[model samples]
Target: MIEVKGLSKRFGDIRAVRDVSFSVEKGEIFGFLGPNGVGKTTSIQMMCGLLTPDSGTIMIDGKELNPDSTEVRRKIGFVPQETALYPDLSATENLRFWGGLYGLKGDALNSRVEDVLRLVELTNRADDKIATYSGGMQKRVNLAAGVLHNPSLVFMDEPTAGVDPQGRFAILNIVRELAASGKAIIYTTHYMDEAQKLCDRIAIMDLGEILGMGSFEELRDQVGKGFQIFAKGDFDGPKLAHQLRKEYEGEVLHSGRGLLAVVVADATELGRFVAAMKAQGVNADDLKIKETDLETVFLKLTGRELRD
Candidate 1:
């Protein structure tokens, strides 16, 4: 239930976000994905009423974003990219402070604190100081504070940034559980795998612009068949490639060694390519086709490596 239209933000002469627009449906996990410094945080800040955009509108449940409105803040939760938690306070104490800020008190506040702590699986450590918790634990606590108020919409910025693989999985599971509970989530990350697993739809941003937006399959189809076919080292390269191209109308590139890069419209061509290769005395079992995934789509669309 969040909508952004032509959202643009400028810092002096530089624009952090340029006419970027997208929407998040109620109870859906929408991903805001991009590389570093690509306006992800800037856009999120404006949506949370922490920063005002220079141009555009952010509407939440038909109510336009007003930076000073407590009513707006009441309906939204923000777990920032950075840790805004108190290192000295216990997990339960930290949540207590946050819950109180939202006008929660007495039994209502205490129940929320326990509910979110359990949701993040920090109940056993709820009384321990945050400094004793690992980075993942701290991030979980950070997430708990955001949702302690049970806001209808939550914005998570790099929620799993410093966590290990296990922690990342735990955090991802929590996000999924939240969506199942009917919370609309705006999740941001640089990890393609995370986005692939967590998002119902994704908006890929780069250089302050939305380069693409759609379901993962829709975006993957946009890149066509960038798949590759690899075979054993002794197989014929060019002659076999020529026959496969003639049969399937595919582009063949030698992928070094005996591996052949076959680009075609669909995987049905992959079967035909294998059959042709077998007819020419090559072992079909030695052939393997690698489907183009989201990482490949990102590299093609941004023309840059994810680490770069």
Candidate 2:
């Protein structure tokens, strides 16, 4: 339901978004995976018509998103990373205020407010001031305010950041429900597991360009049979890391925490490495044998850790 072509944005010498192009079909959850300064938010801003792109086009349901066009605003709901709500206003009151922006009034607006509040599981606190809510609760209210207009597309930026596991689960479930009901959702987050669970497809970005785009399995296959192994202990990191490189004939990465993280050629090599570690008197706890996840792909493409 959303199409972007050659989307580019620049600020002086720095190109924040560079020729990024992707499409989201109806009922799809497309993950815009990237680090903090990877232009995910900038791309979303252009797509939502919040900022005019230096070039390219954003088409939604076959209609272009014109910043001056009220029609585009009617069809999109944006829930940003920050909670954009009036602290003194009650949850219900906040929804009413936003819903009115989309021309929703009287019973229609009230019903949507109630429905979204219940969906976000903030019904009991609907009448309570937002200032009294926890971080997670405030996030739920923020989300409710976005969808009160029942827009066909929603842009959610870091929706689960800083929330507890229960709150995260609740928000993810609500996202799933929205996608199942045929709403195209553009979800942005640094959490690999969350993207894996929620996105039908993903676009990994860095330095104003799209490094890769595909399903998890597809991206993993790009790195071939290489798998990562992590073992935490008071081991000789550099020595063990060298041993891994020589033994498996693949790259080995060591962290400052005396943790050995290696990329081996195959799963068989992973098993052998574990056995060798045990034989060498290394405590095998914190052992993680994982195929290339989005995080690994991010690192491989960007030449840096996701946190960096």
Candidate 3:
């Protein structure tokens, strides 16, 4: 439903996004995963026509996106990272205002407001002022407003951030329902598990560029197969790390606090490493094998350095 190519943006001397490109399909959740300052927001803004890109083309439903085109802009719904609601307004009032902006009015607007309130499970608080609601409740209301017009495509940036687990779950279910109902969603979040669970395809971004793009398994395969062994017991962590590095050509990610996190190329090496550790008088109290997750793949592709 959407296509972006060679999307790049710059502010002054800083390039917030550079040659970043990806697409979202109908009824699919395309995850834009990255750390802070990785150009996720800038790219989204450009795609949503909220900001002009320095370079690249954006097409929605096969038509080239014109930021100034009201018809094109009306086809999208944006649920921003921050709540976009009036504190003094009731949830129903907020939805009415947003729907009116989308040219919704009278019975059509009222019907949509009711449907969205029910979709977000906020019907009970629809008449309550937004300021009086809890943070999670306010977030739900924000989500309701975004979908009030039932846009075919939605950009949900960190829709679940800072919400309670229940709220997060509800939001996730809503995303699934939206996709099932044939809405193409471009979802961005710092949460790896959410991306893994919801996204049909993911694009990992960093330093204003797309580092990797594919399904979870596809991205994991790019990082290669590996097993992380966590063992807790009495052991010379540094000494064992040195030995593993030499013998099996493995890397010790962590070594301290009566625990060792070792990465091995082959699973068979796990047993051998355990025996070797025992031979070195390191008695293992607990040993567990951890499969590589999205976070691991992200770190591998993006490096372990903290980003601002």
Candidate 4:
């Protein structure tokens, strides 16, 4: 339902996005994963008509997107990272106000307010002031407001950020439901697990560029399959890490805290690893094997260095 091609944006000397391109299909949840300052937000703003790109084309539902076109804007919804609702207003009041922005009024507005409230499961507290609600409840109301106009596509920017586990789970379920109802969703988050759980396709972005894009298995293949060994107990963490690095020619991904994490290129080397550890006189009370996950793929593509 959405297509972006060669999208690039720059501010002064900084390039926030560079030649980024991707698409979102109907009834699909497309995940935009990246650390801070990776252009995820900038890219979303351009796609949603909030910002104009320096170069690129954006098409929604086969029509080229024109930021000045109200008809095009009416086809999309945006759920920003921060709460967009008024804390002083009740849940129903918030929805009503947002619905009115889309030119909804009277029965049309009231019906949509009720429908969205039910969708986000906020009907029970519809009359309660937003200030009285918990963080999770407020988030639900924020989500409801975004869909009040019943747009075909939605952009959710960190919808579950700062939410507790239970609340996160609830929002994840709602995201699935949104897709099931045939709404194309573009979801952005720093959380890998949430992307793994919800997105049908993912695009990994870094330094204003799209480093990789695909389903979980497809992207994993780019980095190749690997195995991680976590061992703990009476072992010299740094020394063991150094030894493993020398033997396998692999870097130690983690060390310290009485534990060591080593990444090997091949899973078949498991037997050799045990023998080598024993030969090193390393005694371990605990050992666990971890398969490559989304986190591994992300770190591999974006590097492990901290980003602002």
User: For each candidate, how many residue pairs have backbone atoms clashing (under 3 Å)?
Assistant: 0, 0, 0, 0
- What TM-score should be assigned to candidate 3? 0.86
Residue-wise C-alpha lDDT for candidate 1, range 166-233, written one tens digit per residue: 99999999999999989999999999889988899999998889999999999888767568555555
Q: Each prediction's Cα RMSD?
A: 5.4, 3.4, 3.9, 3.9
Model 1 residue 74 CA deviation in Å: 0.8
**Candidate 4 residue runs with Cα over 4 Å from true position:** 230-246, 249-288, 305-308
Local error of candidate 1 at residue 88 (angstroms):
0.6
Task: Give the clash count for model 3.
Answer: 0
Better of 2 and 3 by lDDT: 3
Models ranked on lDDT: 4, 3, 2, 1
Model 3 Cα lDDT, one tens digit per residue, 1-308 = 99999999999999999998788889999999988878999988998898999999999988888767788888899999898899999999999999999999999999999999999998998999999998888888888888889999999999988899888988999999999999999999988889999999999988899989999999988656688777778777677776656455566756765767767776787888877776666777988776776776776777552232
Estimate candidate 3's RMSD in Å: 3.9
Error of 1 at 70 (Å): 0.9
Runs of candidate 1 with Cα error greater than 4 angstroms are 225-289
Best-to-worst order by TM-score is 2, 3, 4, 1
lDDT of 4 by residue, 1-308 (tens): 99999999999999999999888999999999988889999999999999999999999998989867788888899999999889999999989899888899999999999998999898889999999999998888888888889899999999998899999988999889989999999999988888888999999999899998999889888656787776788777788877765555665666665677667777766677777788777777897766877776776676553232
Q: What is candidate 2's lDDT per residue for 1-308, written digit by digit as tens?
A: 89999999999999999999999987899998888988999999888888899999899989888968788779999999999999999999899999998999999998999899989998998999999999989998888887889889999998888999988998999999988989999999988889988899989988889999988878777665567876778877777766655445556643435677678766677778877777666775577778777777776666667872
